[model samples]
Target: MSRYPDVYKSWQSNPEAFWAEAAKAVDWFKPADRVFDASQGAYGRWFAGATCNAAHNCLDRHVAAGRGQQPAIIYDSPVTGTKRALTYAELLDEVEIFAAGLASLGVSKGDRVVIYMPMVPEVAIAMLATARLGAIHSVVFGGFAANELAVRLNDAKPKVIVSASCGVEPKAIIKYKPLLDSAIAMAAHKPEHCIILQRPMERAALIDGRDLDWSALVDDMRAQGAKAACVPVAATDPLYILYTSGSTGQPKGVVRDTGGYMVALMWTMKNLYGVEPGEVFWSASDVGWVVGHSYIIYGPLLHGNTTIIYEGKPVGTPDAGAFWRVLSEYKVASFFTAPTALRAIKKEDPTGSLISNYDLSHLRTLFLAGERADPDTVTWAEHALGIPVIDHWWQTETGWAITGNPIGLGALPVKPGSSTVPMPGYDIHILSDEGHPVPQRTLGNIVVKLPLPPGCLPALWNADERFGPSYTDEFPGFYKTADAGFRNEDGYLFIMGRTDDIINVAGHRLSTGAMEEVLASHKDVAECAVIGAADALKGELPMGFVVLKAGVTREHADIEREIVALVRERIGPVAAFKTVRVVARLPKTRSGKVLRGTMKKIADGIEYQVPPTIDDPAILAEIETVLSNRPVVG
Candidate 1:
């Protein structure tokens, strides 16, 4: 056995002794029949036979223990220009109202709802409502354009879409209604009803008969005598479907069941983040995406720990000091942010004491993710904030923090830029192509060897539909994390870069699918292709090549500016585009894929074969014509 028995002892040494202790650490509804289901597969079940509702763990258990009055969330709305505090009791009340509203819509068990809104309180409401009704929610990052949104709408076939007029940003306003209209128009199965939340932003007049205002729905629910819809649910039932960027022409919707997600989330929050009751925890991420869905909404709530949701850009209406202002304003106990913000902040105002402006005396920990974290970035935050900057790692498919320097586990021994050992009981390893574990220091593909945490996703939404082809077909048995990295001898995991087409721009992890989704959002755009181009400024900049709707002029930087602003407003300023190239058409494969490789060659100044399947080879000439006029940023 290793010197640290808890650290190195094998499962064979004492199986029950290991997982049983972990299971007890987290709050569960009922005891599980079995902890590990080996007969099923490597990705077997956890907390089997356990009955748990995510909302229950998030509120009831903590509230029952007299922590109801404890802070649950501290919200910031740009319209209000003030921070609003919410206790667990108040949050529960709000969630209850929305849950009942979802019930009012006849959203029941098994129905899937799409939550396509920015980081707002309503986003939380939609998720809890789904969990409360036992309905699965598929949260597409609100940053996506209409065509992308339409594709997902067609795939998931949601019964309803909960959206907002706009999610605030440092940039221009994003009118979501138009996209909703376009997406709804194209979707194979249109939602029976559309629920829209009009932020303080000036939205176009609501579509008559088709859209219902959110405030009106809440009003109707209030007028009626309705109790909280805190419906109980099974652990194994589907909770949410988060789509990952697809390399094979289509996005893969990864489904994570309720019980498994709860187990993993609760464990990570308490252990990985070292969250304590009443301590303020904030993730500077929009609920439109996974970090927001898991940590910002579910994880902290499950723990009854106070969570902070900021509804503006990190550098909103002011300098980068805006983030520090929020940190100081809330006295956040722990803060998690992407490295992209840190890099831009550092690059622009190097050697400045923006960290000093914030009274982070309560700041115990800082976590970084959404991209491969640069070591220097974390070190910078540490020096500036005078706190431990914990660089963690996980993906939308993983659901919650997997490998992290768990601060609450005692004095955390951290290696800057390394995602510390896998959270307890998670068997993580770096393997070469053949599925064999590589030596500790050698770089290789990242894969989870043992049964992953309960927080891990429940395969693609249509598992039988696309399972053997996308995920399992490529790497059998072990769960493949599509990033390239290796574990250090110290057992800390380090992510190098993406093994997929996805690009990490300014710390925001966005797939080319998501980027293309942004470009296609333009009113004058038909289809779009986004590829990563070299940039010393951001390491990689998303260069969007778009096919415009007929009659749109190409010389107009107005469209480029609008698309860039659209991304900024939709996904926060972090995802803003570096270049928006208006191309006549996208290079394609014989099968109609957006010949991304050809785009890559164009980005790299190399000639490549464009398959005979390209719908209009002339579009390539248009792309070349446009590029001849622009300067390529190296």
Candidate 2:
């Protein structure tokens, strides 16, 4: 007796009518005549012949509906010791002023505006303002290097750049101005105007003519009584271009459409997250990432839910209790975060004592994304938090959760290692390398049948040619996810790492995720990652790097032996899981995905390019040090 079984059946029967009904949730200037048009092949147009303003629907409509006094955004920064809440009415005023300010700077419709700022309230304001003017925004991660920033700027060719003077981290004050100046100096296409948000802690130098202070422009607009009206754009208009790391050196800009994106995210708020209007929601992710873009800014506001902008690390910001503290203080109903954050907390506090201190009665559900949540971590969290730990699977390109545990519809039976059934509007199938359907329980490539659900990436910015080839060329009319996984008889999808992550040991393909899950189940292992290292005899051998529990002072040799035995017993001897090295930390991206490719290269003694998006470059050197002392396994 699921509450949404009928809804799912109806959507499957007639997807066009179903999505058309869902699109009505948002305020559209002109309603769409057709729900989906796939005549252009894999690059389909959704909500054709419709007009809408994304920013207006997210802000103004909520105010007009008499929810103006409801909390819209709650900015919580533990590092800066700052907390502020803005209601829908106040948020609209700020957005209007900023939108007007951007217009005054000659930023109009269709212009690209690059935002290189931290996780502050102004970051969301700048994005809303950019959308309000029908300009496309590209937000680069604040922690990205100047060279990385320059590459994005050169690609987007933005007319104006909005950035902050400094970002406050727990241990250091990151002066963003120098980075911005360096990037601007390096880029061939320089922006005409730069708007800088000055933080009082550490101010950076600003060139008088080129740089405009945020307060000066906004205050001037307020004094002059200028109001910026939201501009209506075509349904297929680009809302934002997010650059995701490509296998090659260059990053791919994933373009999201305004009309479809708004409609899809609104549906997700009610269905996936089970969040209602005026409820508090917190997504502990940076605005640079897609999770922050959909959940932190657009999705919640589109549904009139209060979203929390958190600016602090998971473990180091005071203690491991930061997440629990935020939940208790804000009375957050749904909490979304990455598994890496939970692993970090588990490493520091094995007994969950830090979490026990906070009362999280208001926390309705905890959603895990970004990377695969290890079963051990999932079990630990569920036992400790006393709430449903939903592990949903999605990508930056998908915009929202594709396959998730539909707790909002009905709490499905918990499957420890699986990201449950595909939501309505998505037709997911497991296909072999030859693009044929694979049997249940057999590992294969995961693909979505075209046309992809609304809110999916329409095309890569300036790389329309690459979009189809990258996603759909392998399987005609199907979007190859590049992820390796299998769906069970019950339709529960279990993602078993990436297709490239499969290791051929003695001609047998083995999943690194399967091996890592086995190793992580060890009581002493706090976190672990497995990568296939090149072997002369077996083609490739499984190598594991593990981080032990904080208080566990067990000898490395003993722990490694136990983990090797555990893997052997669980995955059998075919896995060749012999080498296990205990490391202090794993090389990971800011989003918490392990650099498995980098680890494989380091272990195989092959030259590798260091990814610029890595959270800590020093961790690579640490892994190299660990590998140098350990002899290669045969």
Candidate with the greatest lDDT versus the true structure: 2
| Candidate 2 residue pairs that clash | none
Give the alpha-carbon lDDT of every model.
0.70, 0.91
Separately for all candidates shown, the number of backbone clashes (residues 3 or more apart, or on different chains) is 4, 0
Span of ten consecutive residues with least summed lDDT in model 1: 1-10
lDDT of 1 by residue, 448-524 (tens): 66556666765677655576554555567666777777677667777755565656676655555445555654666
lDDT score, candidate 2: 0.91
Which residue pairs clash within candidate 1? 58-301, 58-302, 340-506, 590-613
What does candidate 2 score on TM?
0.99
In the order shown, what is each candidate's alpha-carbon RMSD? 10.6, 1.1
**lDDT per residue, candidate 2, 1-634, as tens digits?**
5666777788889999999999889898999877898764356799988999999999999999999999899999999999999999999999999999999999998999999999899999999999999999999998578988998999999999999998888988888999999999999999999999999997778897899999999999999999799999988899999999653477999999999999999999998899889999999999999999999999999999999999999988889898999999989999999999999999999889988788899998999999999899999999989999999999998999889977778878879889888888888988988889989999999999888888999889998888877898999978888999999999899999989898899999899999889988999989999998899889998999999989998899999999999999988999988899999999999889999998888998988888888888999999999999867555
Q: How good is model 1 by TM-score?
A: 0.78
Per-prediction TM-score to the true structure, in the order listed: 0.78, 0.99
Q: Which stretches of candidate 2 lie over 4 Å from their true place?
A: none
Q: After superposition, how far is residue 3 of candidate 2 from its true place, in Å?
A: 3.2
